[model samples]
Target: MITVKAPGKLYIAGEYAVLEPGHPAIIVALDRFITVSVSEATLQGTINSRQYAETDFHWRRSGDQMIFDNRDNPYHYILEAIRVVETLALEMGRPLKIYDLDINSQLEDQGGRKYGLGSSAAVTVATVKALCQFYELPLSRMDFFKLAAIAHFNVQGNGSLGDIAASVFGGWIAYSTFDKDWLRTVLQTNTFGEILASEWPGLKIELLHVPNELELLIGWTGSPASTSRLVDKITIAKFAEHEQYQHFLAESQKCVQKMINGIRNHHLPIVKAEIRHNRQLIKDLGFFSGVTIETPALQELCRIAEDCGGAAKSSGAGGGDCGIVLTDHTVDQARLISAWNQQQITTLPLSVFQLTEASV
Candidate 1:
């Protein structure tokens, strides 16, 4: 049996702008994860994905004839992972040959898909790891990262690549977008990929599961947001020759730099300040409007977090999945949970994981 585990991720900075050529982003892999264990199939029948109860998936292969039984549009995530793996296998000159396989997935919770944690990225990483193991292919973490990025883009149409990078590297990473000159002239000329293949850098990070003290409350806006649309909107707004958005991006970058300091020095105050400031910059871009962040529940929750001596911000793509709440290490998790319950907001216990040499 091959057991593979992948970590979730959180975008610390450079959300929308990271799509640009010369921008950078930062993300941290969380302790939360999705694990896949694969073994040879004993019964030759059909492959079944029994992870999500709400979704039914079945695929059969009989002498080159294949059939896929699915309900929802299988392009979102898990299905995309399967497709990407199949494609990668073919690219490696190995046509996938599996009689049958069973996949069981565990989301953060059984009820709702939570935010702040990158579940999609975790699933993508796990899928890649499982495929690599099954094929007996030797691949570095960065290689898996590249595969996961392909899966992510297939699902979201466009991805920033930060989440996959964080999950694979498992530390705070400075994911700077290379300038055209850097990518074309420097990297291509110097063969940057070869350099990375030869040298590995060591970084320090801690992932903690403080379930009791560090409670997080997340709410949805009852509306789905397209990550690609948000990216396009930000790009147009930032490059439209508008001074206001230009200022916002500049300020956001500065705040992100402060966040980097916070991570390096373990300064909670700096992290909170930078995240709060950056949230405002995102808000100014009009992405937060008419979305979940504009919902009364989210606004009230933000106020509650602030009153309780903490801060909160929308997690991914901002149309709303979840939000991260910063609180004191001594804060009462039960109290926060109870408060959120009263307000009809669901709570999730956050985890902090420290990257190890072996794990990374």
Candidate 2:
């Protein structure tokens, strides 16, 4: 059996500013992950067929076709991922065919849904990693990153590519898009397969559970918020006022230093402060409609986090899947968790780690 454990992630800085070119964003991989295992199988259908069992799923290969089934949506996401690889293989004139393959996964956060962490990206990374092992296909982290990006676009219609990049490369990364068509990248990624691998280590992050005991409250306004809509909003907003956008970009950049200080010193205050300011900036840019953030449940959690001396903000595209919070006192974690429970919201106790790789 081939087992791969991949990490979810949290964006530390450069939230909306990443839409502007030349801005660098920082993220940390979380202790939570989506684990995948592959074993040689004797089954019917195709080598690429998928099946699910509880937190696990299997994909088997038949003679020439591929099939997929899974207990988790992430598997559907992965099946979309493999189609990307197949397209690439065909483009390169090295068409890949499956004999029979099985896939199983364990995602331990938000009942296996995305809670602001890169769940889709992590699953995409694992799928590619497993495929690499299954076919003996030699690929670098960068190559896998590109493949995951394709998968991301397939699933979400549009994505920043930041999450997949962090999952595949790990550690710290700086990614920016200067114009409409170009992206610039620099990796301080933590992994075992690079020349500077010996010097890079995992980043330290303290995960806080807001006391309310609510399973992370996700308030969708009954419709999914399209990422493209948000991105286009920012694009038009930027051109109308470069000076303001430039200033916001510069202020957002300051979060990088704040994050570094918080991580290095284990100072929760700095982290909380940065999160508040980051959320405000994103809010100021119109990512939050007054109504979405105004939802009673969401507003309650935000108030609870603030009351508990923590900071909270919307997670994904804001119309909501989840919101991320950072707390001040570890001692108050219980109180915070209890508060969420009382409110009937979900609280996930997650740890943050910068990207790094295991010895293969």
Which numbered prediction scores highest in lDDT against the true structure?
1
Cα displacement (Å) at residue 185, model 2: 16
**Tens digit of lDDT per residue, candidate 2, span 1-360?**
677766776565566676554565656555666666665545632333223443344445543346556434435676776776665454445646543335433333324343556666788888777766665666766667666665675666544667776676665455543232321111223221331122211222222222232222222222234445666666666777777777778888787556555655656666667778777776665533222322446556666766765677665445444556665434366776678678766775555444434622
lDDT of each: 0.59, 0.56
lDDT per residue for candidate 1 within 12-121, as digits (tens), equals 55676566444556666667777766666532434345455455445565643445655564425655666666655655666565544344544445545445466677
Query: What clash count does candidate 2 reach?
Result: 52
* Residue 194 lDDT, candidate 1, scale 0-100: 47
- What number of clashing residue pairs does each candidate have, in the order they appear? 8, 52
TM-score of 1: 0.74
Question: Could you tell me which residue pairs clash in candidate 1?
Answer: 205-354, 206-353, 206-354, 207-352, 207-353, 207-354, 208-352, 208-353
